[model samples]
Target: MFSKIDLKSDRFVVVFINDILIYSLDEYEHAEHLRIMLQTLRDNKCEFWLREVGFLGHIVLTNGIQVDPSKIFAVVN
Candidate 1:
């Protein structure tokens, strides 16, 4: 399990890592929560492949979880 980033802004939360940008949006109160989540991931040193990121509205799924899906790659099996 990973700790979550907490964001206090309604705007989207974007983190620039390895030249790629990971973005996520949430309700105003959720802003701080997003920040905390990001921080937790950083603390744990989780390896994230930006190219495989996904998005769903305000949700961002990077590793199998429900995410934006924009940077996620489709697996051909």
Candidate 2:
């Protein structure tokens, strides 16, 4: 599925299994990138979860990506 959509990694999009993360420097670019991804997913007949989505156990937010505390603890222990 990822092969079908052409995106610059860590710039526009990142994919892992069924999970997909769409990102951009600003709102306008983010919207555009999201639209492209949604369209691609729709065309591919793939559905995405609006909630409960995370990348490598980390949450991607406007401020920055955060590692899950539980995951960190597990690694530390």
Candidate 3:
């Protein structure tokens, strides 16, 4: 399923292990990406938690992706 998303996302989605990262340059584009991504997941009947999705030391949230602060702290110290 992750691979499917990666393949269909037109460079807007990435999957690493069990996590996914979807991104775009602006709010509207981001929404469209999210809509497409979520539709794919739902079509596949995937068990998903929007807030719990992330990858490569970042978290996907309602607003956008954010770097995990713990990772930042670990690198800074």
Candidate 4:
């Protein structure tokens, strides 16, 4: 499904089932990358929940991806 999108840049994009994580080193490229991703999803007739989406129990933010400490604890213990 992701093959349809051109992701050959320095940015990172990871897709899993209904979740997608788009990252870039800077803001301008990140916006462009996000636009491409959203367009692709719309073209494919896929619906996404913005508030519910996360990658491997981690949240993607401008600073970086953050994992829930509880989830890490569970894995460790």
How high is each candidate's TM-score? Answer: 0.22, 0.63, 0.54, 0.52
The TM-score between candidate 3 and the true structure equals: 0.54
Better candidate number, 1 or 4, judged by TM-score: 4
Q: Write the per-residue lDDT of candidate 1 for residues 8-54, one digit (tens) a residue.
A: 22344444332223345434544554455565455355444343543
Tens digits of lDDT, candidate 4, 32-54: 87777776666465433344335
Candidate 2 residue-wise lDDT, 1-77, digit = tens: 56775455556777777766765677788668777777667646543433334579886655677887777896788
Number of the top candidate by lDDT?
Answer: 3
Local distance difference test, per candidate?
Answer: 0.41, 0.66, 0.69, 0.61
Residue 62, candidate 4: C-alpha displacement in angstroms: 3.8
Q: Could you tell me the lDDT of residue 47 within candidate 4?
A: 38
Question: How should the candidates be ordered by lDDT, best one leading?
Answer: 3, 2, 4, 1
Candidate 1 Cα misplacement greater than 4 A, ranges: 1-26, 43-77
In candidate 1 the C-alpha lDDT for residue 48 amounts to: 43
TM-score of 4: 0.52
Candidate 2: stretches off by over 4 Å: 6-11, 43-53, 73-77
lDDT for position 42 in model 2: 64
lDDT of 4 at 30: 68
Ranking by TM-score: 2, 3, 4, 1
lDDT-wise, the better of 1 and 3 is: 3
lDDT for residue 51 in candidate 1, whole number 0-100:
37
